[model samples]
Target: MVNPGEVPTASVSDLPSQDLVLLDVREPDEWAAGHAPEAVHIPLGELPARAAELAELPDDKPLYVVCRSGGRSARAAMWLNAAGIADAINVAGGMKSWHTEGRPLVGDREGVPPEVL
Candidate 1:
């Protein structure tokens, strides 16, 4: 079992699109504001109810979890590991870092550019 507080982490730059499952755990408003286009939206609050949805993902690929900052994603990663998704990892610095690094984001609200809320 993966230990709590020991989830693996990687910077946004290190995350390549083809290799892993990007799980965005932020809430709806935060997600709608901006998010990695390829990321799967399973808000942290809904994870318990949607845990089974993750079973369809390939086991060979690790699950990279992200939120507005690192805090919520870290909790989500720990919870995922505890719930038997052993390869879940927290995206260090989260969307804030992703935005700062100039990574592409999907949604923009009211003509505003995509940004971490």
Candidate 2:
């Protein structure tokens, strides 16, 4: 289990523009609702088979993961770390918290898409 204090996380307020890679594991619909501008979409189900998609990230560059809340991306971060992508970090509370705080988000904003939220 992840120690509450030990999980490395980045608040939406503190996110930087470059260097770090923001990976969003939410499904396409959720992504359509909104996400971070710097974030890239790579749904969790595709991560294992699509590891090569992240070849662009440097070992020293931080990798931040987020989902609708905190669950999926947290697991994805752990998985990435186990696979030697140790820089992966789970952004606690995910997009919901970001939105709650009125943080910036990208993509569609019409409503929460039905496929994922």
Cα RMSDs of all predictions? 2.0, 3.5
lDDT of 2 by residue, 1-117 (tens): 555455677776676645657899988878886887777889999999888878776666788899988788878888887787557888878888777866666677555432225
- Tens digits of lDDT, candidate 1, 1-117: 555458778888888756568899999999989999888899999999999988888788889999988888998998888878648889999999989988878785878877778
Q: How far does residue 32 in candidate 2 sit from its true spot (Å)?
A: 1.3
Candidate 2 weakest ten by summed lDDT: 108-117
Candidate 1 residue pairs that clash: none
Summed over model 1, clashes come to: 0
Stretches off by above 4 angstroms in model 1 are 1-4, 108-110
Question: Highest TM-score: which candidate?
Answer: 1
